[model samples]
Target: MGESGAGPGTVRPGGRTARVRAAVLQAAGDLLAERGFDGLDLAEVARRAEVGRTTVYRRWGNPSALAADLLSDMADQSLPRTETGSLDGDLLANARLVQRTLADPRQGRLFCALIAAAECDERTAGALHRFYRTRIAEWAPCVEQAEERGEVPPGTDHAEVVRAVSAPLYYRFLVSGDPVDVPAADRAARAAAAAARAGAFTR
Candidate 1:
């Protein structure tokens, strides 16, 4: 299906690739949200994307791979980092976004299911790891800005600070069945900011 000299024309090589990727990702996401990881079928995704089965298989390979790309797409489309000019402000924004996503019924369950699946599947784990890496990197810049503003100590490990911001949300997502509301977002933000203020992110 994909080997018939498609010339990647149908896929737009670059632009088309992005377009088709978006379509496939959107379809895959809908399936994931509706069906969970186990229910996502590549064939259905191909049909929905109006792309060839070969294209779907050759491009993404498997359900886990598709799920990985789906997450990647979501991260790419996520809102740009907020620049609040203060440690608490920036951290709260990050925390709030994360909490809101995880607090959503479908998104939260999908993530929990994906993480659990990743624990036993290497391919899924790799994708999930890359997704988290992208997310953490996306939000790391706020911490760097904070350091430049003297809100936190110099040489703060921005990535760690970002990770800290997400720790509680992830904890709540995985450890407990508690609702990750606005207050939880605030707590995570404040806790991470406090730790960074005390040099937890230094080094």
Candidate 2:
């Protein structure tokens, strides 16, 4: 909703407005990584962003709305999926990307914080779900292409295969406390590919 100035959750226009939004979101991310959602104060974000408090308040209303906008911005700016000509290769690329993001010091903590926020906040949870949907949709075509090549059966749940590639990596990131390493990523991709080959993802 924070893409225009039409309502309480609206973002701003381009040029200076876009710059302001970028700064605010960056600050929000940094704060979330550092102090988490409970510590996300509008005034602090405004101070960190060097924007007026009124601007932050008017544009994003509250911390939940600001976090939602931050998630939306992340989705909009995320890189497109890699196409590797095969389901395994494409899923490996997807798995590697997710692993890298989860292993990054700042990004890992930021994601953990956002996920924690989502557990107790409806708006943040919706935004988090939307963010994953965008990312999954970007990668779903890889499975569709695999289906075209008969690597997987028809009516396969392309999105589910994509999710399967990342699920283990996220488990390492958010739960098991294990290393989210390249080897783990490779295993995840391979496992998902094997599952899809067996029609585990078929509708």
Models 1 onward score TM values of 0.83, 0.93
Question: Please, what are the lDDT tens digits per residue for candidate 2 over residues 52-147?
Answer: 999999999999999999888888777787898999899998888888888877778888888999999999999999988888888899999999
What are the root-mean-square deviations of the candidates from the true structure over C-alphas?
Answer: 6.8, 4.9
Which residue pairs in model 2 clash with each other? 2-10, 2-11, 3-11
How good is model 2 by TM-score?
0.93
Kindly provide the TM-score of model 1 when superposed on the true structure, using C-alpha atoms. 0.83
Model number with the top lDDT: 2
lDDT of 1 by residue, 102-195 (tens): 7776666667767777887788788778777877777788888889889889989999988888888777778886777889889989999999
User: What lDDT does each candidate get?
Assistant: 0.75, 0.86
Off by over 4 Å in 1: 1-17
Off by over 4 Å in 2: 1-13
